[model samples]
Target: MNVSTATVSLALRDSPLVAEQTRERIKDHARAIGYIYNRRAASLRTSRSGIVGVVVHDIMNPFFAEILKAIESELDRSRQTFILSNHYDQLEKQRTFIDTLLQLGADGVIMSPAIGTPPEDIIVAEENGLPAVLIARTVEGAQVPVFRGDDAYGTALATNHLISLGHKRIAMVGGTDQTSTGRDRYHGYLGAMEKAGLPVDPAWRISGPRTKQGGFEAAGQFLALKDKPTAACCWNDLVAIGLMNGISRAGLVPGVDVSVTGYDDLEEAAIATPALTTVWNGQREVGRQAARALLDKLSGASVKPSQELIRPELHVRQSTARPVERS
Candidate 1:
């Protein structure tokens, strides 16, 4: 017990200032004494908590499950403690989480910002020393590293696929214009429709549904359209699946009487009742790269504030087919 407190402190911190043998001896003795390292105090001293924040729309959503899994894997390798939250597209809830992270001295944040999230919100996080990396969604004018699939292109692929199947009357289900993601996806669908020389009925664009339940409820609305669509290109797999369920309840089978295509090729997409045909939006890649970039920032590396757009691919499944010709 004659060791100087300075030597003990250095040894406890695993500082190279102490000899290897001395450091090991101190650690062993400290362990025997049941001494607990005060990470909070240490964090207060070094301003590093070794904590990261990850907030998504809804973790329960299958669309985000794959992305979160990939992100968890990447952050685990760096031994970072990640705190996850669901904002449910609520701006205040998301800001509250960000504030909590800032107060707790979190090193960085990876977020899929909620709808109506402003660039200033991200800027505030950065100004307060919480660097943010965007995934799945983007805040306009936010100068931060954003890693997400090319949503516009992805939706276009799905729309074009339906067009090829000879569905002139296609309905776009789910999503709203409050977010960049929503606008991009809708524009993608519009682009494809125009390219195919198909008339886009204003009623065909149904917005404000981003979940399975929402999509299920939209089924009746879709069915009530003056010129009912023979095919529906859903915002995501959840909506697509839900709409199919609603359709089935109405005594209609998906992929037969009505063709459907979903975005985000979630695992369940392949195993849905009819096996969904969807666009693979690179969820895993987006998560992995976003996490890696944030970790790099935490390591004192300079990251270019640019968009890393991962291209999407289409997976044809049983959920879609040529629309049946009406007599």
Candidate 2:
């Protein structure tokens, strides 16, 4: 039996205008024919697209990839679709992506803001009644709900662990004054050193991009120093691995000659030569929370502009150890 589009529509909507027997017959016929409803046509009637946008700063990072997977899984349960874009930590790219998603009629957006981008653009988007939530990293003054890991607390834990291993002259790698995460981790390292009454030398602190190459270059800089630190705290696992490679090139063994610690505990951290001692930030949890916030907004539920911080866990591996002798 062939079913008409109008009959199928009525059946799908469960319209009272259709008799019970007719609706059942239409539904059965539609299913038998493998007929799929046109979501766009349905959206035209209800004015809901059931689409969300996700903007990530670094799509290349495995951690972000994992988080994206979690977001996709959660949204799948609602039969909603998401559009994805990568900002590459560039403000212009982020702005363009957001505008494009808006033009594409995204119901809401979940974003990790580009480094140094002001929140004004996001504010404008929200003013247009577009619900958005910040994930992983937040805009400075945006009223959007934010979900991220506790950077300071995590860094403090890593640094304290190094200190407990009798590493007093510890160096820091892969942080700059640009991003809040970098600044927070740096401050945490400083705070830990201060609490232990350990003096942090200016030469031991290095600033570079949060990339593998950046970590490699920073490690070379540290090796060039006359008074080298026995242990180094890196921004992330990628950086830590890069630093380890550079240390090897400089004729030193990572776990033996110079202990290293990393953050984020990316998958590669566990497979590194010495394995990396790093902090595990709950990236999937951040993604899930951000998705939940955006879904709440899309469902016309009231959601406050609140910040949720997920605690981080330290994974101690073979990458770090106590100094063999005093510096």
Candidate 3:
């Protein structure tokens, strides 16, 4: 006989409404047949979908890919499915995707907000009774928990390394003064230069899109300068690689003439022609932490709204060295 899961559950629980002999026989048959209960069905019966929504700024970014992998693994362990959306750095697109997820009945959400996204969306998510955790980037006025790597510290380390190599006229390519990560990293660079008593020239700094083409164009601008910087620190590995390409096209060798540094330490950074020197942000660890935080919230656990700042490590490679004259 094909018994329903509810009937089996009733039998297993030995409900007083069921005859003793029938309950015992059903339980014995279930055990013998290795019948397994479906948690999703049970959750649906209790009015839950067991679904989560995850939104990333850019899915093409290797860092985000790693983070997504960790989140998927964690959710799988909890028997929850996730719907992922890529914002492509567009705030409106992000908002639409969020709304769609909510309409589709996601139990909760985790997001890396698009740059310059207002805090009101986060407030709305909370007001709708959907717990949301911010990862990598946090909104200015959002009360949601945030988890991110220490951008300031990572930039400071990169700047100090260049300074130690006798590069006083260093340029920062990529990233604007808009997002908190960009602002903090710029501040860290400024702090390092000031502490070293080096002159900070605004002309050496270039703020633009964080894409490879943007980096290439910025590198061209810097290379055309009458007084080009001896070293350049890019916002991320992709930018650094593009900068390297632009520098080469300008008849300059990357490590030999102008040193380059990048953040994130992505896989391509190490495999590039001159092996980029970069800061490792521990993307996987950041992902794991975000997933854990979201799961805690889903389990009705009291989680304090706090920031988790992961320290970055400097990975030295062929891309940086002391000034040619100094060597």
Among these predicted structures, which one has the highest TM-score?
Answer: 1
Top candidate on lDDT is 1
Give stretches of model 1 more than 4 Å off: none
Candidate 1 residue-wise lDDT, 1-327, digit = tens: 679988999999889899999999999999999999788988999999989999998888888898999999999999899999999989999999999999999999999999889899999999999999999888889999998889899899999999998899999999988878888999999999999899999999999888899989989998889878999999999899999999998898999988998999988899999999999999999999999999999898999999999999999999899989878
lDDT of 3: 0.85
Error of 1 at 259 (Å): 0.4
Clashes of each: 0, 0, 0
Ranking by lDDT: 1, 2, 3
Please, what are the lDDT tens digits per residue for candidate 2 over residues 1-327? 466777768777899988899899888877899988788767767767788888887777776877898899989988889888888888899889888766656688888888887888888888765688988776778888999998888889999999999998899888676877888888889999999999999888888747788888777788887778899998888789899999998899998889999988888899998999999999889888888888888888999999899999999999999887843
Residue runs of model 2 more than 4 Å from their true location after superposition: 1-7, 13-20, 28-36
Q: Which is the better candidate, 1 or 3, if ranked by TM-score?
A: 1
Work out the TM-score per prediction: 0.96, 0.92, 0.88
C-alpha displacement of 320 in model 2, angstroms? 0.7
**What does candidate 3's lDDT look like per residue over 1-327, in tens digits?**
476756768888778877788788898887899988676666667656788899987787776878889889999999888988899879899999878866656788989988878899888977876789988887888887899999999988999999998898888888978788889888888888899999988887788748778777777788876667899988888888899988988898898899999999888999987999999988888888888998999789988889989999999999998877633
